[model samples]
Target: MEIYALYGPSGTGKSTSALALAHKYNINAIIDDGLLIYQGKKVAGQSAKYEKTTVQAVKRAIFFWEEHADAVKEAINHYPIERLLVLGTSRKMIHRIQGALALPEIHHYINIEEIRSSAEIKAALFDRGTQGRHVIPIPRIQVEQDFIHRLIAKVDKIFSPKKEEIGETTIVHPQFQTGKIHVSELAMKKIAIQSCEHLPFIESFRKVKVDITNTPVVEVDASFIIHLGQNVNDLANTIQQHIYDAFLEFMDLEVEQIRIVVSHIQIESPAHA
Candidate 1:
């Protein structure tokens, strides 16, 4: 089925526009994460953010989407009685999604203008707008500045926020674990999962859980294995790389020694992620 993706920074009204269009088109339902109801059935949303509640929301939307996809294609002669639409971030992402679904091009709805103004950002944050879904930090794009600057502008509202409170700051307990410490395997595992927020492939990161009872070492279930757009080998390497990157962030330790524990690949995004 073709997706008229509504991609924009935090509160670009993607969901609203999707619904309005759906109504105007007389199509069955809205296909993103919210306002999902068509013909008394629900639709599915994206699943990159794997929180239980959020996943349930996406799955709910997906069911409705899958159920209505074909009907949508057949019922609405013009889909809009005027036009059809597809939405998402860069044309690159939208195009990728189009090919994946064998969908025709969207009528085209690109709105980076919302991202250019911080005023818009604030409104989106409070209004519960579409919110960024590309889900990658600025520096993470691995692209040249001009392009990176533009992309970052579009998705800056979503990032791994720094931890801070009041004027008082607490220490991060142990800096390093060399000889032996009370760091439980479960603790380390928990740390890894928590840190996944700091990198890309947030969805894929869910598959592997960590265990530490194995002594100064740790057991990891790293299986990031889907390179949407990147060097296949490089993509594999990145999954491990970003995990370790997140692992270190979670460690929050100022240790001199380093231990790299890699298990397997789970899910993979493109190189830019």
Candidate 2:
């Protein structure tokens, strides 16, 4: 079987990028944290994130137990997995998993830095360290089947750059993680409106809405009154990009869509002739 390995330090977003990478490379299966995810479903094995401690999680991730390795290996064989992706913290860890499953040599190695920018990696690490949020590259339903007790949230479906639907990711706060924080819709709404501050063309906001139902992925709708004679298309695009960048920089949230509406044009009153 053709194998690919993606490695980075823990919490650098390997799992978050897994489905997209797999879709990009046409890899049909992923071995992530002791779970065998095939075509966006968990076909076999337990999630290492379900463990009670970081040490146990590490052991599970590496397939320390013979039974765990056997189950995943059998599942791999059952499927026509022409190519597979394995995620780990480093090359050594990937090799351990490869040896445990007796899988073929890794034909390609991808670094998380290649898939994500430095700023993105920093944001991911902040989320892991401060928010205790970890991503699993499977649907929320799959994660719920095994770990319903822990708080779970769904991210909006991931899409490739060409707009192909890759898959969904579930946020799992591991048992070992502690503390919980919440960001309300009001805060997000304010951020969306505030993103327009630097643009002189924007006169005032008519309406602002933020959707946090999707957890880490947010949707913002903003309607604004703008100065007349400004390029509406350019202004809308600028607002979209500004808000999208703000969410990432300030909240570490991904904006799935930012809908910009030019509600009314504020034309200056003409002096009496």
Candidate 3:
């Protein structure tokens, strides 16, 4: 596989702009913070951001643990990757990840200075130092389950010059500031059910499944039946919007995705046949 590196100091917006860079370079897989990201999905390995201390986080990032190294290596072997991007603070750090993953020698190097302005770097560092926010190149759904104490936020959508949507990035606070906060799956299900309770055409919710695996940014799968004569498309859209708005208003949490499935439709009968 062809290998490329993006080298820079930590918190210099490397991770923030990783997706756009990958699009420009045509790299399909990325190795960042000890995770293997393919096509915007995390397929294997735990993130270094989950480490409790800076030293341990560094160790995890460079694949110091045998299990960690082996897991990422296995994932690389499993996927048919053509080109890969390795992100790190320095060439030495990139080389360490390369050796750990047994990838080819670096075919190209892209420096943070080439991509981000000095002002942007300063802003990023300020955010990192004061807010403890770190960017993961994958989407929020990919890393939500792994981050409990951290506040997770999704980066805005990026587009190529031609207007092709590249993907998204996630901001996370890795260092635990407060104790772990737990939001139960049942609670989320209730929220989903309650949100759609008042919709005109929604007869009843047949099944509601809330995935807290990705905490803070939750994914809801709701199966319900709607009254006949109701436009399925319109009902689905309204239900999705209601659930999303409800979560944001009530819990102050972002709804990453809501999938509304119409399992049945109720048709009203005339007085006489």
Candidate 4:
């Protein structure tokens, strides 16, 4: 396979601009932060961003674990990829990744400064330093299964200069520092409750259980009473959709499973003459 490298310092928006660059060069796949992305989907390997500490994160990114390296290598060999873009914080890092994956010498090297303005780089640095947010060039659903629960995943849309939609990216803050931010169980339940309240057919929620046990992958169990004459199955589906959308759009949390159990049905009586 022909290998291309995008090299720059950390927190310089390389991942943010990767999709646009890939599109510009007609590259079919990308290797970023220990994940393999093709056609805007994550097809192989776990993300280094899921590591708990900065040291571990770095190691994971460089393919320190044998299993991680083997998995990515195997995927690369299995796919019919002709051109691949490898992202790294420096040229040396790119070489390490290329060697680890057994890829051929990089045909070209593209610097972050070449594609992004200084102001853009500064903004990305500030966000990384202050908020600890990192961008992954794959859609949220692809990584939601393995992403840690404490981190939030926001969908980021990238567009070319011509305003053509390139692809979707995900922003997440990994647990690489002490005193990492937490999304409380109560807060998640509140989101679920609010979602249920907005549905016209839902009279009131009997219980809203937000399960964060597996986290970043949440399971919601809700019990509610619906207004009479409403199609039970239809309303249940609507409620599920609303809750799913609310969590993803508002909280950036992925809801893996939503179970709606009808506890009661309320009906209004005819007025007396």
Candidate 5:
């Protein structure tokens, strides 16, 4: 079990690089905040795209993170500190945790500060909505040499998952491949809600409040797709069309990319699925 910690200033591509490492190393389990995780070969993580920059949105994002504590803890325990390839920043936080946990094999906390260039460190204002700064550096924290050694041991575990989960092509995580894949033009919270209105899936849906123009990115829970339609394929197709048009109508451009997160799937119900 090997734990490689990747963290740097925001937008430094820590998560992105971690994903790439996972794919390359053939490792499993990536734990992070604001990620729409799923059980599949590949998962698309998402955050709702917003047109208006507001303080409320920032609070909500933070609140949502607090809510996932149990889920994250479970994932860490199941895999142990050894197997986790963490996208983290709080060294003091991680250190305190390390002191508490009595796992001898858990070694390795590879800080990604080595990758962040000085150019990236320079601060610049970004159009990121309610969030503080789009990309801010997390100050480096010094840890004791003894702790570093212990962490290193845990990280060097037997690479589990027999057979080649990722063959000759080793790119463990998509996030590592690039920065967040956001359809900025389509920033909507509700999938079926937005789909029903612009795309014409359901008859009754409230209007989406966020601005779609200028910013064209959107967010969706890939798993939580519409199922209560007459036909699933028809719903899927209609949903795709709606997402496309919304991008054009709001953002006033052709949709270059559509990042889907298959996080939620509508199950069959007594009324309809």
Candidate 6:
């Protein structure tokens, strides 16, 4: 197998840039953060981000567990992996992964600095340090199905140099991120209430419930008293979006579902009143 390694410090955008580099080299598979991603889908191995602690996360990344290493190796053998791209924080880390999986030595090494500018690296680091954002080079659904992390957004389209869409990437806040705040459901309800009030058509919320049972994946149930005039469908969608944006902005938690029900409709528009 022809193996290539992309090495960089944590939060330097290695994972973010993995697809572009893979496209450049026509690499069909990528080993990132202890996950085996093939053709933009996670086929095998667990993500290190799923680990509860940083130490455990690092161990997972380096395939410290025997079962983890065996699973990834078995997947590699099953697939026609002629060329592979492995992402790590250093060449030694790449070597560690190679040793764990019993893969061939890296034929090429690409540093994150080569593909990204210094300014870009700084911005990535800032996002990681402040917002605790991590990028996984796979579709959002892939992460959502297997991971229990705060999903920020899914970049559906990643264009290559030829303007051809390469693949999807998901942004997430892992459980082990430092300085992760704990916001009460009441605070989330307040945000949802404020979101409803911002809409001119929404008079009041009859009920606002924030379900945090799933932790990062929250569900919001909001019943609003809306004014009559505008289309109710448009109004409901606007309320949902507003509340979703509010949670993402104020609390940094992505509300998975924002259920909006028009409990009552006022006779006149708020503007007319």
- Per-candidate TM equals 0.29, 0.69, 0.63, 0.64, 0.32, 0.65
Name the runs in model 1 displaced over 4 angstroms. Answer: 1-5, 24-29, 33-40, 43-85, 112-121, 126-273
Tens-digit lDDT track of model 5 for 193-228: 454455433433323333333233443433333434
Please provide, for model 3 over 1-273, each residue's C-alpha lDDT reduced to its tens digit, 9 standing for 90 to 100.
Answer: 998899999877888878888899888999998999998889998888888888888999999998989999999999999999999999999999988888888999989989876545655654565456788877777777788876785565667779998988877778733333455668777887788787656666767776532233334344445444556788788888888887767665556667777776665534321
* Tens-digit lDDT string for candidate 2 (139-233): 98878888966888556589999998879999988897778666666887778878767676676676777754433443434344554455678
Look at candidate 1 and tell me the lDDT of residue 52: 34
Give the RMSD in angstroms, all C-alphas superposed, for model 6: 10.5
lDDT of 1 by residue, 1-273 (tens): 343555664334343344334444445534333223333232222222222344453343333355434444344333333333444435555554445434565764546454233333333332232213222111222212212212222312221124321111111111111122344546666665564444443334434444321111233344444455544456445445544565446543221222333345444455533
Task: Tell me the lDDT of model 3 at 82.
Answer: 95
lDDT of each: 0.37, 0.82, 0.77, 0.78, 0.37, 0.81
Best by TM-score: 2
Across 1-273, the per-residue lDDT of candidate 6 in tens digits comes to 999999999998899889998899999999999999998899999988877799999999999999999999999999999899999999999999999999987899999999987645755665576668788899987888877656554454677999999998888878888674455668767888877676666666667777643223333344445556557788778877887787667755566666766767656667866
Off by over 4 Å in 6: 180-273
Per-residue lDDT, model 1, residue 27, is 50
How are the candidates ranked when ordered by TM-score, highest leading? Answer: 2, 6, 4, 3, 5, 1
Which lDDT value does model 5 have at 211? 37
Between candidates 4 and 6, name the one with more favorable TM-score: 6
Sequence-dependent TM-score of model 2? 0.69
Model 4 residue pairs with clashes: 149-215, 149-216
Tell me the alpha-carbon RMSD of every candidate.
21.4, 5.0, 13.0, 12.9, 18.6, 10.5
**lDDT (Cα) of model 5:** 0.37
Worst 10 residues of 4 by lDDT: 212-221
Candidate 5: where are CA atoms >4 Å away? Answer: 34-67, 76-82, 93-106, 116-273
lDDT of 4 by residue, 1-273 (tens): 778899899988899989999999888899999999877788888888888888888888888788999998888888889889999999999988877878888998999999987546755664565567888888788768788565665887889889999999888877774443556768878887787686655666766777633233334444445445546888788878878787777655456677888776665433310
Superposed model 3: Cα runs more than 4 Å off: 176-273
